[model samples]
Target chain A: MTAATASAARADDPLAIDVHGLVKSFDGKVVVDDFSLAIPEGKIFGFLGPNGSGKTTTLRMLCGLLTPDSGEGTCLGLDLRDEAPLIKRQTGYMTQKFSLYEDLTIKENLDFVARLYEMDRRTERVEESLKHLGLYARRDQQTGTLSGGWKQRLALAACTLHEPRLLLLDEPTAGVDPNARREFWDEIHALAETGITVLVSTHYMDEAERCHEIVYLAYGKLLAKGTIANIIDNTALYTWRANGKNADRLASKLRGCDGVEMAVAFGADLHVSGTDEAALEAAIAPYRHEEGIEWFRHKPTLEDVFIHLTAGSKDNFS
Target chain B: MKRPFSITRLSAMLLKEFNHMRRDRTTMGMMVVIPLMQLILFGFAINTDPKALPTAIYSADTSEYTRDFTAALVNTGYFHIVKETRSQEHLDEMLTRGQVQFAIFIPENFTRRLIKGERPQILVEADATDPVATGSAISALNAIKPRVMTRDLKGITMANPPAPPAFDVVVHRRYNPENITQYNIVPGLMGVVLTMTLVMITGLAVTRERERGTMENLLAMPVRPMEVMLGKILPYVLVGYIQATIILMAAAFLFRVPVEGSLTMLSGATILFMIANLGVGFTFSTVAQNQLQAVQMTFFFFLPSVLLSGFMFPFRGMPVWAQAIGEILPLTHFLRIARGILLKGSHFADIQADLLALVAFVIVSTGIAMARYRQTLD
Candidate 1:
């Protein structure tokens, strides 16, 4: 249980986390239902979902911090049901909010965590954590005075200081700037290189693509999950872009039209999608022939998949 | 128009404060109700007039004279005959069991001795469990003594002697001779008020950050729960100590309250109770999700601590079930220990149980707070 013994990764061991048929409910409402996945060791797995799609709950359940309603899992080679405490000891959770000791200096905050873990040479551990996080220069500064980016860095430093094998980040870069988000992702990738498995939930599409793999959840149900190309290739829908005056108005009118599965505004253009390419073309032929408008065949983006999937999905919790 | 300073900016700041106040109805209610509550607590419940004395009568003779005396004592309303025994053997049992506060025994030659111009001794025993109540009993006896013995034989003085105030009344002020209410409350309020303000003020301090999205960095740190709990509570403990000392000094100098006991013991008790109270604050912080809710929760705890804890009311007078509830409050035992140390000069052994209770409270509260805080960390 010493830090030296705990610091090493258990990579040669079986899956860092493995769960199947994970179901979770709150107040008789199912939040995460029939979820199953296996996260390989030393990979940054990204969880992408529209808000309130049970992403956070699924992550919580997978980490052994929460028990599923009817599913079973193992985290860090220990049965989650019987060894949650042990699993928690080795898992680091970086919450979306800045949840550090504001009144305490950055160095003092790290020292406190080091002491909590009962680590030997707390000062050395704190120094090492700060240096690893590139926060040594601002070590003595009060954590409250730090910006969002620095706060994110400090949070990562603290969780990793105890050298947890797994890190669960709940929208860690939520309000962080693009540069800081990139830096955070870089640190996450670096942690992964050391064989620390990282599971991150995010709202940004760019961040999603940065992960080794992506799992998309809508209304507590996984819609499409794989590499960006694979997910796009699996969908049978074809998209056509329309550029014109009041294309936003056209998108509304195309919804409920035959063969037009989804019509969504993409900036100054409207991207129309349908599983039946002929019917889709036929439905948009009249609108395309109108004045002051031009149409072109377009490739489907992740945004198109998200809008199409979520529009058709029922609000299960509501 | 360009030259004018921005009154709108100052007004916006003031408006922001108003909006905050409007959003937090709990604070608004506290502001409106606290003054009225303080008035009732200090003015009404805190009183020196201890009434309802329980007593026992052991009439061994069962003569007409003994019966009359027993009837007179019962009719006075000051004594409620809690136990009536046929023999003196049960008198000790009654007092020890706390079934009756005092016992009076009229011996065999009661009427016969009085006819021989000899003073008959009417025995009286008082249970001195509570000194304040015992003092009132002794004072009441003192006031009634002359009337009992003289019997108002107007314009009739004996040629030999003016009936030399026929009988004497002996009173024992068991614990406190000069019964002063401040001697008890001043030291206790030092603990109670310091506890009320410090625990509640710091209880929500960290929770506020957590709610406002600032706690992420806190959890990210290398700090442990105990460190965070201590760091948050220690500054407030020091503040409580300083406030307690100031209050105690004020009570002594301004109120002229005497600390008949050891000041060191009182201070020790105060600090111990203050730390226990901080543990309570930690519990509140762990349970409450926001600063407003934390304040509400702390006050919810504080109201009962004031009412049932005997800091404002006498614990002895309450029903046993009610007293059991009071015993659960830290302030109750704290007041008992502080009053015993400050007013009665009781040694450490006398207050060991109170100290143990406070220590247990601190341990349980700290454990609960840590466990709950960890569960909700994410």
Candidate 2:
């Protein structure tokens, strides 16, 4: 993991979380199977996976909330097994749901959290948290009555009150409006700049693109990990577009052909991608001469590679 | 900015809590009304008074003298003759099997002895298991039969010959003195009140945090479970004391129930019981999924605690199997200890077993709760 981080990350701060062969299972079904990763400090790390692919479980194991069945690893330079409470103390976790007490006012919620950590000068701390989250005006409003955006801000403030070193955000902006989500992400980025490492799990393509690096998991296994450009290159996938005239017709013909892992029509254009360059060329050779059809090679987007990779993988649950 | 916690933070939380209480009517009502409602219901409804005690009459011979003696037993009202039998075998069975509270027998020569103006002996047998029940029935018999014997003595001097046969009657009540119901009931009420409010109010503490998502925030902070437990329970302990104080005052004022013993000792014992009960409530919070489930679990605890504690029925009156089941409950020992001290003024030597039992209960339940509670935060 140290080697992986040294070779890959050239950020201002280095890796803060490094783990190897992290494994966990429940009721004989492996939930996180032989996973490993290096997350750079002071940067947003995005974890993306389909539903029930062990994304949450892997995150739990990484944060020391759940123990891996068999693994040797370190988080914040402490042994993962022996130093869970120590890890928990310095780490902040934002669950998927809005969990703050609905009965308490926004100020009260933050104050209670402040006291739990036995923070000094609690009144001033609560004031700053309320003001910093842009919740000063609504400080007296009950948290249950607050809007999604405001509630998210309160949750964020409470989690960060103790100035934790790492924040594990599980779909932090899941239900917020687009503007609020953007604002929330901006604060997260700001926290990262202050040397607080953030590990975020998201499914939105735009959010995935915002991450410094993305790790993709499928069926409890780490399928892909790298920068956006690097992951595309590692898949060895070639993508081509046919738009003019018979694009739809050409898509129908390209389906199920050897070397063409995925082919789909996007409105007037058909995108075709595959791993084998020579076989793809041979398969599309006849179509290149087809009248009124234009073809051009293009750099594969992260979405294109993801669709192709998932299309070729088998469901582990079945 | 202040740190995660300070006196200011706790005060701020407390102030906000007060504000919420003012705005939230249901919570305020719970704080005010539930205690009073429980006080009235438990204080009056739980009693140990036994009514309509049955006694069997056994006559060795059919004679007018024996017949008149049977009539005297019937008028006492404390005992009713369930069966009239000729054989001593049935009398032994009736007494040993607890079918009757008492049995009386007249010898075959009782009338002849009376005719001769010599002493005629009538024997009364009483079950001594429950001292109060036995004592009350004995008092009634002693008061009524002596007057009858004196009248018979006058008749012999006037017409028969010398003096009538002398008769003796004995009265006995079991478990309590003079059949006082308060002796058994006051102790049971203490346990019932502790079970109702302490387990319920504190049960909502952690679930409130979990529901509010503040628990995650707390977990993310440097606070340990021990600190959270202490901070969470300290306030509720105050509430528990308040509840205990109200119940004690009500019991004394409304029911005309005297302390008869040290109030300080009662309060001290109550604090230990509250600590045990609050820990149980904390455990419930960890087990329950939400506020609703927590309340449900509390009532589920309360019903058995009330029924099996021997509050309504004499412990002796219940079948041995039921008695064995009753012994497992905290209320059983709590009632015993409360009764022993308040009514009997029992010293530590007399109620030591009950105190030890309550201590054991506190240890086992709290240990289980602490173990499970830490896991929820973990």
Candidate 3:
């Protein structure tokens, strides 16, 4: 399709990224295979996957940092292939690694990016970004000397300084602390409220829960995609929360039992889950009468569903 | 208790380092390739006492005596007469263009003066820009008079065989009359210094970005390939100029090397040569995966440029195949232009061919670098 027509079709959809059949491979190994998704504008979309599950690859393709082997799509209402430069102009991408110049100071890095985008009042924009990211005091410090959390904050500030319509973050909070991650999510929500679409990939379950919608990928294939409650409700897995003294120790005993797909310990409680309701009941029936133990039926959590989904998918390398 | 030096631990470290070394194929290949290249280049290609030096003859007299004299000089295996020009201007043009190293000028009354024992003069003008190149050939010419006249005077009726001939061989070392080596070397060093710095500094530019993980971010931005290339090279142009200025100052004051030609023209030509080297470095950066590979590639290019660019040795001294290879190097052309302008007081028109060569190198190298630069990670 022509770039204009492809873009025209998505104009009415209010989708920032509307790509389909996106396939990318490196050295004969398919990193992102037959991937397709449409993210509406101003939505916080989370991508959860194991390592090397094509999360970064898909994020790169969405932001025009990489081209798919055989795909026809549009990013920011522009053709992914022909109008990548246009897409890149309007989209902000924060890489999985800290990709800014380490030798440059925080202010210099921001000013460089600002000048690249040819923003008016570059010094003001750099100052505002530094102040907003709480990096004003450290503006003169080299980026290489910053802590991981501060570096992540600076990277985010640099990416959003131009106020791009869409932001594609690849594992943005991978090595960050919990407090910094929370602050980052708060900023993400604040940006979303200002009508910025964000597509972020992460391995954190809590982060996945914060997204308006999430997609679980495994081995270059999408396993499940929906809102947190929707995905949990869609799964047939029944979970029984067992709480007692030493209830977590019963995880190994309950594992490998008939119809018990996963029996994982969550701190002091044991969550036994399975797809078949009758078989799952029979396996947990013997534990129901255990001394001082209380077994109660509960809804499956997002982590439970993720583990179950990943367990079902075959490991490509192995 | 753990021992301080355990064989198992040492073996494990060795195995890990071996694995790391094996994984980087470029470094491993460079290790083997650099040594082999140096052996071939330094061993077989380099020749200090250059043979078969290109000679141009401007003889007013083509008599049997001149023929025998020319034959005797050629028999020395030092001078190879490539062109016999009638006009003195044509002979001068050949020397200025570096087409010929030696010019043999025989006077009009050479045969008659010799027959009358009038001590006729045979002027031999050698391009002494490179003193080492002409040193041996000119010394060889001193022995040629006896050999030629012994044959030519045999047919003549001379009562006594004069210990010395009735002829004079006046050797004129043009451009550099003193035959000072520093005069040639100092100017050539400017070209070599600029080449080494410009190529290496710009060569590491893109590779540093890639190695530091910043290339992904740079590519993801709205910048164009040409923008990146120009941005990376422009600052280095100023750096190259500073380096050129320092070298030129040192050559003039420290070594007392004469800047006979226009300093303005030298500055202009040095800029073009710097851009050419920067272009070559940019091309190398695009091909290299990491900074180490980039450095190795720079050294690989630098080795041939220094050895074959007539910087250390004479241009006319090497064989035809080696000269052909040297002709392709930008430094080879720059060395000639630099020496010609600084020492010979040559004008822009004189070094036009070498100037055009540097421009061509810049264009081709920049084109290759732009083509090879990746705008996307794919």
Candidate maximizing TM-score: 2
Clashing pairs in 3: none
Report how far residue A30 has shifted in candidate 3, in Å.
Answer: 0.6
Q: Please state the CAPRI-style docking class of candidate 1.
A: incorrect
Query: Which of candidates 1 and 2 reaches a greater DockQ?
Result: 2
- Tens digits of per-residue lDDT, candidate 2, A144-170, equal 898888888788888898788888888
For model 3, the superposed segments whose C-alpha errors exceed 4 Å read: A1-13, A315-318, B1-172
Q: Write the per-residue lDDT of candidate 3 for residues B62-121, one digit (tens) a residue.
A: 888899898888998889999998998998899889999998899788888777767678
* Candidate 2: residue A136 Cα off by (Å): 1.3
Q: Report the TM-score of chain B alone for all candidates.
A: 0.60, 0.64, 0.59
- Chain A (candidate 2) TM-score to true chain A: 0.90
Error (Å) of candidate 1 at residue B86 is: 60
How would you encode candidate 3's per-residue C-alpha lDDT over A279-306 as one tens digit per residue?
Answer: 9999989889898889999899989988
lDDT of each: 0.72, 0.74, 0.81
- TM-score between predicted and true chain B, model 1: 0.60
DockQ of each: 0.10, 0.33, 0.23
Model 2 DockQ vs. reference: 0.33
lDDT of 1 by residue, B1-378 (tens): 121223332332233223334545685455334433443464346646455578988877766556666666765556788778887879878888888878888888876665444767888888776776666666666556455444422223243222456456655555555555556667777766766776786677667766875554344333345556666666556556667666667667755666778888777777778888888888888778899888898889888888899876778989999899888888988888877876777889999999898888878877787787763233
Proportion of true inter-chain contacts also present in candidate 3: 0.58
